[model samples]
Structures are given as structure tokens and as C-alpha cells.
Target: MKPASSSLFALAAAALHAALIALAINGLRAGQHNVPPRRPAQVQVQLLREQPKAAEKSPATPVQPEPLPQRPVHEHKPRTIPKPKPQPREQPAAPAKTPEAPAPTAQPSPDAAPAPARSNNTAPPAPAATAPAAPVKRGVFVDPTYLATETEKWYPRQAKRYGDQGTVLLHVTVSPAGRAEKVELKKGSGYPLLDTAAIDLAKSITYRPATLDGKPVSDSFNLPVTFQLHD
Candidate 1:
């Protein structure tokens, strides 16, 4: 090869390399202008899955109510109370066998004959010689036996043992009611104990009241009470 031809080839090759590099730069600029802007990567958000609920229960049948209590049959019936009857009191029966006696008849018999009349001269029987009706004496005098019996219990036991016997006279006033109203020692016994006992016995004694014309009257009497011991 000639040196002139080699120099011409070298110059051509350098121009072709420079044109390819400019064309590649222009294609890159067009691609940049034509391309749409890329959107940012979409973020995937996954929610937590909710657990399923238990299945709903079916509705149950309603319960029946119990029956109410019945009222007593006796309460509805009307009661009829009977009244009590009064009873009669029993009476005592009279005696059955005894009979009443008949009354006496005083009428004379119709068939009897009449008697003859008496003479006028016959003197009427003289009334039996009349005697004075003795005045009835009604008085209670002092009785020695009764007084001794009454005062025997009052005798002092010591005096009786000593064989001391004495008599006491008491002036007693008797009331109409048969009671001794007052008693005093008219003549006292020699022993004062005997005299006091005699006075008390006189006051305690009761006597029948003296009567004048059938009516009771008061009177005074002297009574002697003797305390004698048996030998």
C-alpha cells in the first residue's frame, strides 16, 4: 500500500466512529424524552384475618304455668245451726195412800119423841158453894240444894283438903228476864277466898223470874251457898 491511501482510510475510520457516538447520544436523549415517569412500588397491606364466631343457638319452647289451687266445697255451702230446747224442772210427788176422815154430824134423828116440861117450883140447883180462888203464888225462892250443887265445883281444892267448910250469904237482885242483875256479900264466909267465890257464883246464876198477876217482875232474894266437905 501507498502511504497516501493509508492516511485517507485512517481519516475515514475516525469520522465514522465519531458519527456513531453522536447518534447513540441522540437516541438516548429521545428515549429519555419519550419515556413515562415510573410510579413508586405499591405497598401490599395484609389485614389480620378475624376468627369466625360460634354458630347462633336455636330458640327453645316456652314453659307451661302450673294450675291454681281449688277452693273447699264446704266453704261454699250455707250452714244451718239448730237452736237448743229448754227442759222442764221435776216436781216432788205427794203421798199416795193416806185418806182424809169425814166430818161429824150433829143433827138429831127426825123420828125421836119430845120430852115433858119441868115444874116452876123446883129451885134451881144452887151454884156449888163458891170458894175464893186461891191466889197463885209464882216466885223463885232460893233453893239450898241447887245452890250447893252449883257452888260445889267452885269450892277451893286447898280448903277442901284442909277440911275448912263455911257458909256465905249473898244478896242477889234478880231481873224480870231470869238473870241475876246484881250480887253482893250479905254475910261473908270467915275465909275471904270462899266469900269471893260465893259472890261470883251468885252473879253467874240464872233464876226463874217472880210473877205477880201472871206478869214477870223483878225481885231481890238472899241466897246461902254452903261449902261442906264430907268427913
Candidate 2:
């Protein structure tokens, strides 16, 4: 048989132990349900660096052309040309020897053989003087207005830049049809450039046919092609 007091004490101790175990079990369960598993943190990064090989390139070789052939040297001597011979000059014949005034001498016996048959000397007739040279017809016969159509150079606009503009007086012979047949520059602008231009311009221009007796006749007309520089 156990004492009452002791039994009561023992029962109380057992009840305390049971209460502590139940509390520890409840705490374990709460911790297991509330906590999540731990995982490792991760991070990513990039690095930048230069690549030198990508920029490199090789050099190319240059091309050359073939050389030209050299010329051969010559040793032949140069030839000398001969000058033409001058002709000999002729001497003037002695002036016709006049008869020596019948050498005053004593003549007798058949009159000295009849005076040696007196020579009948005939003289050549005088040459007629050449008629005064017909005055060379001198003048121009081309219409300037029409001449402009033939040569644009006739315009002093181009010649004026070089101080070449002036009048060209000329002699012209026109056919019955007023066409310039013969044209000559009697007086020029002192410039061959202008003179040639006027001559060329006149050659192409035509004029109204001239009439002497109500009928068209080839006649000469003098005219001047004036070249002036003006705005």
C-alpha cells in the first residue's frame, strides 16, 4: 500500500511531463509549416573587349607597262646639194658702123668699080606707143544688207574686240544680173582679217542688176563695207 500524499505527488509530476512533451510537438509542427526552403541567389553580367584582327587588310601590288623599243643610230653622211651654174653675159654688138664718109680719095678708071654697089639700107618702122593703159575699173558692187546674210563675220561685233573693224573700199564688176563677177579691195581696213572678211562677204552677196540704157548691162560699181563697233 502507498502513502496517499506520495501517490498524489507522483501523479502530479507525470501530468507535468506529459504537458511539456505535447507543447514541444506542437512547436515543431508550427515551425515545419511556417518555414520555406532556402534557395541560392543568382546574378548575370557581360564584358566588352575590342577585336583588332577584324580591321586588318592586305595591300595589293602595282602593275607596270612594257618599255618602248629604242631607235637605231645612223652613220651615213649628209649629202651636199650643188648650186646651179650662172649663165654667161652677152656683149652688145658694135653700133651699126656708119660708112666712113666716102674716104676723100682720088678716084679714076671706071669710078672705082661703081662705088661697090651702094647698099640700100632699109630701116625698121617705129613701134607704135602702147595705148594709155585702160584705167582699171575699181569699186564694189555688192549690197551690204545682202552681204550680211552671207557671212556673219562681216559684223564688226566680233572684230571690234580686237580693234579690227573698219571700212573696206573696193572695185567691183557686176554682171548684167547684178551678181558680183569681179571684186577687188582697192582700200582696206589695214587689217587682213577685216579685208578677207569683206572680200569673202562680197563674193556671196548679189546686187540689183545695173542698166545703162534702160537695158541691164554689166557695169562696175564702187562701194564700201563699213564695220563699226556699237551697242
What TM-score goes with each of the models?
0.40, 0.35
Quality of model 1 by C-alpha lDDT: 0.77
Model 1 residue-pair collision total? 0
Best by TM-score: 1
lDDT of each residue in 1-231, candidate 2, tens digit only: 336556666666776677667767777776799854333223222322333446556666667778889899889998988988988889888899777776677658774565566567968799999887644432334455566555455664557778666788878887877678989989988888788888877777777767644567787877677776656
Candidate 1 lDDT by residue in tens digits, 108-138: 6888776678878997888888898876657
Off by over 4 Å in 1: 1-137
List residue ranges in candidate 2 displaced over 4 A: 1-153, 156-158
lDDT of each: 0.77, 0.69
